[model samples]
Target: MTQTVGSRALSSPRELTRVADRSSFIYLERCIVHRDANAITAEDAEGTTHIPAATIGTLLLGPGTRITHQAMSVLGECGAAVAWVGENAVRYYAGGRALTRSSALAEAQAVAWANQRTRLDVARAMYRLRFPDEDPSGLTRRGLLGREGDRVKDCYRKNSERTGVRWRKRQYVPGDFTAGDTVNQAITAAAQCMYGITHAVVAALGCSPALGFVHSGHELSFVLDVADLYKTEIGIPLAFDIAAESDEDPGPRTRRALRDRIHQLGLLDRCVTDIKSLLLPSGTQASEITVADSDIDRVSLQSDHDQLLPSGTNYGDEAGW
Candidate 1:
């Protein structure tokens, strides 16, 4: 990390840009990424690009990217997610960063997930968000799955017709991208980008990505659920458009398109709002999500009757003794 004098001090959590207002994600490869004060400098054979760390929601470190510890520290402090991915950004090996140290949202998510009935309720809420015109209430998990499958098929049909792309059933092997046609390849690329973005938001919110309402059993089940919220609205349509334009370099093209669309649509802000609405209780104030100057680095110990006690104090000489 670069040390600075008077006015150029390190930024506190309160000073960092809100996750919703930041850039969706940046994909970089074959570079050395290091911190330069509040910005991260990416050095390559061509040149060095300085990116404001506070403005980035996610950093997708692709193959051949070597990031320094200082860069990682600054990203973590700025609440930016750092993901290690394979070439062409196809494989997601790991990603994490908690923008907020507070556990309120995480606890709320756990409470909702711990019960069967509430879990179903949250799942219904998620489906409702995705398909606002339809009523997913009282629908069982299997019914929801069936409904989702039908909706996705309908979406594919609609996009194919609108884009004049040949419509076939969605097909692609898990690890094999070449097995799919041009459209499928584009869709896969778009979906991967969506996952990366959603995963970053999930981590930034300090919520467990494994605890999903509709999707389950996988580590990124919740991420999948959130990403699907905009599949029809963003991913599917964009993928079709890419396929219609050209069959070459579908991955990179799709990624660039997705990033631009995300920014233009202000999807990051909407995503943050939707996740909070899904995990937090009804009518929860938006102020609860904001980080205040005093809240930064504040730690407290849980006590009896839901009270919190300040740390670094000796309670042994108190009434109990």
Candidate 2:
């Protein structure tokens, strides 16, 4: 939707065609990305390097990268995905805003989530979309969970056999967080990459990461929902392949392997398409904007408390949600 600064819509998404290089880049060195006059620049011990703010797709920040608030705002406006990584592995910790100004997707998400039947239907659709070969019909949420878990185990076993990396039962030492085992560490690394990509896509579509259909309670629950779709397909293979190499430490190797896989599969584009397809069903347009005239006036008049009656309802206010 086209918009102006004066419009009620808070922001407008930038043109996706503006994506430069057609590829994303990672910043591993300690550098600061900040606004410099008309452009964004990254400065480090070596020297100051200019960032092509308008063209790049996702700008990944590994350890030791510092980004200014202004730079983040610039990236948001540019419709570029910016990700902050975890301490040990390149785990996705947080992300910047989406390019979209429209609230259509978010509102649609809320409406679907608020309705139990619709939410389950959407969940079923998600499962079917992710696993096209599998049948998800007539399955309850718990049933879906059980099936999904079985599929995951199957994937681990299948990949282990293919890669010849003795698939031990999936286990992790929780208190350490740093995976003691190579397979666990590889899995952790791969999952975070998927999360990073999924988070970027979620932001691009202007959906809320906190509101999820299957998974809930935690923030980035929606992100987890979307990323889980590719977990078996992407994460499992990548982790096992890396672990098969007996690569001493799976953290860095997993990051490299996952990045390559993400690029090769064009996972980001797939993510965008999957989100829109799942959220916005075929032949159905997002709702039309029909903000009431009274609603608009109420916002403009709410600033003056004295204009309202003592009961707190505006003197003659009848129009509200």
In terms of TM-score, the best-performing candidate is 1
Per-candidate TM vs. native?
Answer: 0.91, 0.78
lDDT by residue (tens digit), candidate 1, 126-200 = 889989999998899999999989998999999999999998879878878778888898899889888888988
| Lowest summed lDDT window (length 10), candidate 2 | 289-298
- Model 1, residue 215: distance off in Å is 1.3
lDDT of 1 at 255: 88
Residues 1-321, candidate 2, lDDT per residue (tens digit)?
332212223222334432222354354547888865434677888897765465455677766888888887777666667776655565555565655555666767788888998888888988887688988989999999998888888888888789888877877664454655778888977776667767767776678998898899989889999999888888888888888898676877887777777789877777766766667646654333112212122222323554533343454545552
Candidate 1 regions with alpha-carbon error over 4 angstroms: 1-9, 289-295, 317-321
In model 2, the Cα lDDT at residue 242 comes to: 82
For model 2, the stretches where C-alpha displacement exceeds 4 angstroms are 1-25, 37-39, 56-58, 79-81, 173-177, 285-321
